[model samples]
Target chain A: MIKHKALLTLFLSLFAVSGLFAAKPVPPAKKAAPPAPAVITGLTAVDMPYDAGNAAILKWAVNPADAADTFYVVYVSSLEAGGWLEADRFVSSAKTGKDVELPFWAWDGSSLEHAVKVELNNTYGDTLPGSVFQFKVAAEKNKQVIAESMPVSVTPVGNWFRLDRMNNLVLLITIIVIFFWAVSHAKRKGLFIRRIAGLDAIDEAIGRATEMGKPIFYVPGIGSMSSISTIASAFILGEVSKKVAQYDSQIKVPHYDPVVMTVCKEVVKQSYMEAGRPDSYREDINQFVSADQFSYAASVDGMISREKPAACFYMGYFMAESLLLAEVGATSGAIQIAGTDVEHQLPFFFTACDYTLIGEELYAAGAYLSREPMLVSALKVQDFGKLFVMISVFFGMICVVLGAKFGWSAFVSSVLNLFQNF
Target chain B: MKLIKKQIPLAIVFITGVLTLISYYVPHKVSVDYIETMNKWENIVVAFAFLLGLISLFFSHYHKITRKADGWGYSIFVFIGFLAMVVPSYTSHGKQMVDGMLTPLGWSYKYIYTALSGTMFAVLAFYIVSTAYRSFRIKSAQAFVLFVAAFILILGKVPLGQIIWDYALGWTGQGVSAVIEWIMQVPAVAGKRGIMIGISIGAIVTSLKIIFGIEKQYMGKD
Candidate 1:
């Protein structure tokens, strides 16, 4: 009886411990399938012009909290039969945030650049069709999406106009206006401009050569005659040739362009005929040295040295060659009268030559020398325009100063914008 | 009769001017058509005019070469160079021929042209040195001022300037850059503005004369 009781007690204790340890493992509550990513919102499309090779920009809003413990995904499709084929698909961790522009190149071209848009999703589960996107604002604490935002459709419209092109509009208008005004003014009465000092100096220069019995060396610039300024130079050459003919002085016209040489020959011949000294004109009056800038300079320099001309006229467009020619003329003790619109070379000519016509003065030389009334009137109108500009500038400056002191920033800014547009 | 000759060209000028002005304001289909026509005609005229210069170039040089004038060899070289550039150009349409032909020829031109031209100019440096040694001999206050200005300008532009005046050339906050900017802005701008104002006034007076038919130089004769 004692042995049986001991065995029974041990069995009971073992059963009690087993029962205490055998509590069942708790099963997880069945999870509901994640809803599709709260429909995407804030879709935008813009056309980019610079890189038309093949591309566009797309952007959308994302929110992650709405679809329980879900990630966000994006999808895109064409408007054509290929309904929403994934152009580019990507997954996102957040459901409510800004995303960079994604590209969609399905129908991109010069015409169809801004025609694509995108859709977004928050569902981590399998996707279904015929579903509209509704974006939800994410809830705090658990970062759960609370309510969906109105879905935005992506519209592919590339940037409508270029920013750089807008900047050029005013400049283009100004150039056109200036050009037309001058041309019209010239047509009305013909241009009669004042006598440029350099042109005036030309007569004196050639006369001095006649008196001195020294040759007159004329360098008709180192550029082609087709250049407008060079044509202007050639016109001046006609006047110079007439004077040379009348004065019975020898003229040496060295050139760089073969075309310019022919034009120069014609101009000189015509001027001699007009001056009633056609018999005095010679082929040597117009000669081509070289098309090379420095070579021409060197050759001219040699001529200046050997011929020892009494008067040297450096007229036309010059570069570094200006200084070289000026220095040689200086060495040869020639009375140099230089006319050029090359602004950079002006200072060198100012330093070395007896007279130097500044930029634009060369263009004025024909009008001034010939007293072309049309040229003069165009210049007057240009002056009026300049006066208008100055008045506007002065008034604008005053307004700016007053505005700054009185704290009228908005008014000043608007005025500035207007001026900028003007 | 006088007005007919003078006024018509003026009328043409004014009409063209007004048309261009109207063009800027109007964005209508007619305006667009006019602009396109103008651009097309301009391009066509420019294309035709370009031939004048080219023909003149060939004729003038060919005459020189045929007559065996001074520098006839240079004329031949120029003709050959012109043909070399032109022949290959008319042969091809795009970058392919340019890559195969123009590039090589351009390279050769650069070598021959640059070297010959550069050597001719490099001789000037010696001439300048000698000229300076003689011409720059101190003569007057004006001459002295000129000399000093030239010296400063030339030295300031060169690499050795900073070497001589370390503090002057140093990239520190207070240095030559600040001074240079000040010089460019203050005196340079002032001088440029003054010159511009004078030029404007002169131009205005000239234009007035031109419009009144008081100036006749561009008309070929009195």
Candidate 2:
């Protein structure tokens, strides 16, 4: 009986061990090999248009099955055989061809493909014209590269014309033709320009300074020689200084830029010579105050307060310091004239200044003050340009409205594209 | 001498101006290189001009001090301030900070220069208030319009303004902020765009005048 019981226990123990072995979980069938991530297709490399042969645009069609996290790594090489260096990496959905900035006339951008502008100069220091470059793109998922595109090559060459800016070129040419026509016409028949009160008040301001026996202060507001407003101010200063010289009145020109100061000195000297009072032209008329904006304003303000100049002229580019200088001049009982192209600061000038040149008036001041045939013709050309723009805007509005109402998308887009800068 | 001073500069201006205009249309490598080189040259020229400016500043103050001009005492402060900053710069080898602590140069910039600049900037607030007072006095039809626009603009920007707007004009089913947006986007933008268009056309004409040598006032010739 004991032997039979022992045999049963041994059989049960063996059965239990077998059951444990049977219940063990199997390895997850090796994840079904992860489905082999889809590869990008139809890769093409072309030299970027409207560029200096230093960039190439790579485009490729992406498979719809690509995961959102799937990344594309762009590799570039001077040699086709090897030495592939990673140029850029981006997620699958990052860049599409539609995101390109080129106009429709230059590029046929499609939403179905990826596009990238690879700057060759960034990779190879300098990319000479007609230099061959090879590129490859690898699609990666879960940190593993799934597939690579066939190596595509491009020979970047500089283009002669930027087709993208064709509209701008056309407009520029039109303006130039108008300018030449206006110049010839002006010489034959003088152009008519409306009175600018600010420019008209120049003689008044200068005469007041002469009457008071106080110096005239000209603050060429904190702009470099390159600024158009500063150039205008220099011209006005020439005319004013000539008048000052004739009247034997003192004038002080506080400069913010050294180059402008240098230029203004020549202008004042010439004006004095023109007025036949060269002996009275002082070298200290033009002085460099400070390069720092507020410091210059403070120094000018202090001078205006102390010297009690009869008239003050603030012209050129001014920031917040506009009010600081203008208010001080106003408080000093000086007749102040201010002009700037900065639209936001116009209100401050209008409030504080006795005469304020708004927008184009500032540019027109030089021409108006000089009344030269050639200079006045430029103003007429500008007016013609304005008329052209007004007509274009009016016609553009009509066309856009008609196109939208009639479902003429192509016409609307063309009109809109003509107005677009790029 | 005429060739050197007048004709050469005019020729240079004509050549460079035309080339710059052409470069705007052309994307060729040579054109790009020319623009880059020209910009670098401009920076170098500006640096030398800065040196010239420093010399002029020194001479102007020096003359004032020597002559015992009206503000001779103030002129002495200019030299003192210039040396105070420049001496520390040379001694510290142009390092503003050393081991995360301010050097003498840095201290001067922070404690003295920036503080003075900030004080000057702070004074602008009072100036703005005075300007606004004079501007919003309802002197004419234009002034009335400006007053109304400015009042709306200022009122829509603050929390208290929004609360007052909600209580007063909320019945219109649009917020005061919406009115402000319309004023800014429609009327203000229209006026601004008009001015901008005129300015742009003027600028272009001026550029052409310079390029063609029609306007030589900058050359001080008439």
Candidate 3:
């Protein structure tokens, strides 16, 4: 009983100290008077190129409230002669917010007659107009003239695009031109594209799994349904499922997105029906895991381990999880074919998978498998566009080399300009 | 009836495509309104699509858990986690209940999913080293050249390359760095350009065939 009482006393003392340690309420700070308006902070004026005039940018800071009803009256004076003359007027209230830009007439810099002045105002009753002091900017009765900031000198820089940034534009145009050229060339010549060995290998892979009496596992990537890479993956899934159905081999499609899972089920079901093996297809074959990135990876990894499928197909846009999924399949001694557009993850896949599809090859999977004429035709056009771009690049290089000595050949410059402008 | 059933959706799609294309050029208030309407329609469609995903998820997992298949415990974990996320999301409450709840839950999700899963991926670093050590052996003269080029590229990308050889730093020299850039600019870009060209042509032809009814595979076999 004595020990229990002492323990209670100690607990009470600890509670008291915690309460004391709680932060003290901070005192309210004193409010400063709202700032006076029209304190000009910046001025930029430059001589207009190929013209007799100049352009200037004037900036000033004002009370957030005063900006609602203020107007700046700009005045100019010759530095040789002290008196100032009115040059331009800018109203602040007409635009969206506090910031306003005004255009003023250019003054020749040779004339010392270059000084600017400004003013601020608020709306009041009729006949209440009064002048506030020029320099002080503060007056009596809650109205005060704000002090003017030191005027800044303006330097004129013409509005011109940088040469370096134009290189990126040139590159973009070249890419587009090349893309179109290759496409057109392919279309005109009826390019006889060969069948991708990796595609024929899919059937062989599925057949081996069937022969071995083991199920096949397929992951359509961790990307959402809308991604092009994921869509391509779905197309491949359709083809794979058809093959699996014909072989009478069980196939599992573990999905990251629910919509993708539904689509996968439809495509799988359709493929089975088309292959005359509808009875062999199971709805359970296509499973929807969580949409959360890591959760989905864990679920897929779990599915792979428990199923221990003979063959695994990894197709879609993948991140860091690419290696995790591929490595696990490798460990299971399964033949893995992985395809993705993510360049950085390619090395991981190349090292892990039996067959790897590079960037645009993922898109080509449908064409390679289905041999649909439409797909082949489209690829042909894209090839032509690429060729066109390459030829243009070479031609432009030659022109630029020659034009360097001829003082800007118009034709060469124009072609270069098209690339630069594009 | 046929027109209403078939042509109406086609018409809607066509109109939508045209309007979307026109909106890029139109800068008018009416065009802005059309664009806004399209955006709102898309948002609503997306929201409804999300329900489809949710249902599929529940159905998929519910079947697994109820059947007591292998790893049903994981399904139960998923179901519980799904409920945990869904409950707080719909609970109309102050900042603490909604925002603060995600902190712990997200961390748990990350720990279970990313970090542990990433640890599995860390094996790649070792695997790559081992794979390179084993498979990158040179057998032929051509293989030797390829191997040397690969070595230079690997060296040039890392910081240690410049430390080992200053020539690797020169922009104009025909050093390893310059060669790597040339390879990327020439061969890599050429291949990419070729692929892109082929894809565009393929897409256009495919689209035309689909429209003209020349490609009927997508319509489901009779």
Best by lDDT: 2
Error of 2 at A84 (Å): 4.5
Clashing pairs in 2: none
Off by over 4 Å in 2: A1-39, A62-73, A78-97, A111-113, A121-131, A140-146
- Cα lDDT tens digits, model 3, A226-298, are 5667767877888888888888888988777766776677788889998999888877788766666666666
* Candidate 2 per-residue lDDT over residues A1-422, each given as its tens digit: 99999999999999999999899787676655565458778999998988878889999996788888899999998754358878889998877887788777878888799999998777666633337789999999888998899999998888999999998988999999888999999999999988888888989988999999999999889888889888888888888899899999999998889998989999999999999999999888999898999889999999999999999999888998999999999899999999998889898999999999987888888889989988998888888888999999999999999999999986887788888897
> Cα deviation of B165 in candidate 1 (Å)?
5.8
Q: Report the C-alpha displacement of residue A279, candidate 3, in angstroms.
A: 2.1
Best by DockQ: 2
Comparing 1 and 2 on TM-score, the stronger one = 2
Per-residue lDDT tens digits for candidate 3, residues B57-112, read 77877877889877777778777766665554445332223445545446454555
Q: Against the unseen true structure, what C-alpha lDDT does each candidate score?
A: 0.61, 0.89, 0.61
Worst 10 residues of 2 chain A by lDDT: A122-131
Q: What iRMS does model 2 reach?
A: 1.1
Q: Tell me the tens digit of each residue's lDDT in model 1 across A1-422.
A: 99999999999999999988997778999899775545545554443232211233444444433334443323334333224333432334432222222112112222211123232222212232323322222222233443333323323222322333333356445634664677676777575444556667887888899999988998888765435457667767788878888889899988877667776777788788899998998876777666678878977887798779999988788888887898889889999988776666776787778888875676566655555445454454545555666886799999999999999975786456544531
Candidate 3 CAPRI-style tier: incorrect
* Candidate 1 Cα deviation (angstroms), residue B34: 8.4
TM-score of each: 0.57, 0.89, 0.61
Task: Estimate, for each residue in B14-46, the C-alpha lDDT of model 2 and write its tens digit.
Answer: 999999999998889799889999999988888
